[model samples]
Target: HAVVDTTGAGDLYAAGVLFGLSRGAAPDHAARLGSIAAAEVISHLGARPRMDLVAVAKSILG
Candidate 1:
């Protein structure tokens, strides 16, 4: 994704990593989730998600 902003990228990454860990994902997988979340946040103008993260995760994991 094209980067528009960097605000809250770290926080979103942490959130994604924690979420993945809570769901029993492997370390690399968790980090992948974190990367995905950070990518999403940086692609837009704000820290808030513009799309459904659940859907994004499902699509990626599946």
Candidate 2:
């Protein structure tokens, strides 16, 4: 993804990881979710999820 900025990627990544872990995912899965969140943020100009994060994670994780 094209990163317009890197300011909030870390926060988003952490959110993803935390969410995954909270959802009972393994470390690898949590990290993958974190990466997915970071990538999604980097793909656009903002730090927010343009799509629903749960849905995105489910789709990606699934």
Where does candidate 1 have its weakest 10-residue lDDT segment? 53-62
Clashing pairs in 2: none
| CA lDDT, every model vs. true structure | 0.84, 0.83
List, residue by residue over 1-62, the lDDT tens digit for candidate 2.
Answer: 46777767899999999998888888999999998888788777777877688997787667
Candidate 1: tens digits of C-alpha lDDT, residues 24-60:
8888888898898888899989889787877776665
Q: What's the number of clashes in each of the models?
A: 0, 0
- How close is every model to the real structure, measured as TM-score? 0.86, 0.83
- Candidate 2: where is the Cα deviation over 4 Å? 60-62
lDDT (C-alpha) at residue 16 in model 2:
95
Superposition error at 56 for model 1 (Å)? 2.2
Score candidate 1 by lDDT.
Answer: 0.84
